[model samples]
Target: MNSINRILIAGSFLLLAACSPKIYGTVQLVDANLQPIQAAQDSPQGSIVNMINTTGSIGQSSHAVTVDVEGKFESEKEKVTPGMYKVEASRIGYATETETVEIKKFTGKKIEFKLKKILEGKRATIKGAASDEDKIINPGEVSIQPPSM
Candidate 1:
């Protein structure tokens, strides 16, 4: 009976480790000031990152991992297959960034992404509103203060 139980346990361990690639990596979210976000992995204000498996083989599905407080994320051992994946990062006030990351031979990789903030107070300035043929002179907005003239 003891021998049978030991054999069964060994077989189970082998079956569990037979196949499925294991890939790993770290993710980080930084503002325009190049500062690390405190709650980068939290919701509402924290950035959301997902890895979509675009290989399209058969039964493969996309995988989503939560980044740590220090902006680090790792994929599950068997969930991540060896192929091309689309990494997308999104935040509330920051721009959404999408990038392609490949996992070759189940090797670990490091990916870094920088987010650009949207300016709300800055005025939008349109340059070259006039066509080339209809060149208008003195279109610049210049404020001149004259005391006497």
Candidate 2:
């Protein structure tokens, strides 16, 4: 009976330990107008979501997951502890987005991140330059000629 009581206590502790909170969310890659970026092909998969536990030790409290094609992500069951976390989402050609959330035991929190596209500088082009057949003049080889009166 004594050994059985000890086993029961141990099992209860195990059950409690397995009931940690979870964090989930979606990371949408959007344009300047806040519209979802449509992929040329259906299988675009480079987005990443990270949850950093702000109240815990560094390196040990960071969790990361790759977003699906539709930008959905979820933490593993009972993988995250109850605490405050800083969630960040990022993808190529888009600016990273971040939000702070509090995780509670036996409950899940959902966060949404809308990333904006990074605007690139416009390329300079010389349309009618008399140099190459391509008609575009390289910046380093540009020559200004005075117009004949």
Candidate 3:
């Protein structure tokens, strides 16, 4: 009787394990120039990565994770189920980006977000003046001043 109970328990455990699928991926945040954004120590939550399982009902299956200092986020081990996920990355000063991905395995898929900087109010561009004997100013020598309220 004891041996039979042990065998049944083992089979049940195996069945449960087989039913659960593992899903994971990496989210990368970058600027318009394709430069990686690193999180500052002062602002720990540099960016937010929200994953919604679009395969099923909306809002019911959603997960939100914060990116690390390297502006990267990975799903927890076996925490996410295999399905179609709509991933979104957002930052305070940058435009939000979204992508629809199918996460079916545990492979570390890389998703990159190119966020454009949002400029508010007016922006002034000042060009550098020519100096010395050279009457031509250096090209691309432009400075952007923050908009004043």
Candidate 4:
């Protein structure tokens, strides 16, 4: 093909690529009860640090930048795109939860995650009983014991 034809072909290809739509979404952080939490305040690296340090969990993903002013999460709404994403939530002193979010062109979806605090408690309990059907043991007896402190 001539140079003009080649240039025309390349331009057409570029035009088609530019016309293609894009897909996007955001990751939000919430309490175990799913209530919106405030964004982290100033940090050397930014709010993500405060969020990671105070709450321990990062936003599900790095794409969703931290919006401390807004209790809720937000992201740029882009052109139509389709795909599945594994959203994640993390915290230092809390249990992390992840979920899948689907995005489609010309539409928006929300993927909210609720994280729970990492329990740090000492507690225990034990209880049981025996019936006539349990009497056939070599020594049918039920016993309970606590720490020998």
- Estimated TM-score per prediction? 0.53, 0.65, 0.53, 0.38
Instruction: Summarize candidate 3's per-residue lDDT along 1-149 as a digit string, tens digits.
Output: 69999999999988776655433344454555766556441332457888788885654488878877555576665556778888888878778888888766533446766665555768799876567665655668967789999
User: In order, what is each prediction's RMSD in angstroms?
Assistant: 11.7, 8.5, 12.1, 12.8
Per residue, candidate 2 scores C-alpha lDDT tens digits across 1-149 of 69999999999988876666878877767778887777763222668888899897665588988888777898876557888989888887888998899988777788888889888889998667566675765889988899989
Q: Give me the displacement of residue 29 in model 1, in angstroms.
A: 3.9
Arranged by lDDT with the best first, the candidates are 2, 3, 1, 4
**Who wins the lDDT comparison?**
2
Q: What is the overall TM-score of model 4 with all chains considered together? A: 0.38
Each model's lDDT: 0.65, 0.79, 0.66, 0.45
Residue lDDT tens for model 4, 1-149: 89999999999987766545332223344455755455562111112211111211343223434423333444433322445555445545545666655654444555444555444788777655567786455554756589797
Instruction: Note the clash tally of each candidate.
Output: 0, 0, 0, 9
The better candidate by lDDT, 3 or 4, is: 3
Weakest 10 consecutive residues, lDDT, candidate 4? 43-52
Q: By lDDT, is 1 or 4 better? A: 1
Q: Comparing candidate 3 with candidate 4, which one achieves the higher TM-score?
A: 3
Off by over 4 Å in 2: 1-19, 41-44, 124-149
Cα distance off (Å), candidate 3, residue 54 = 0.4
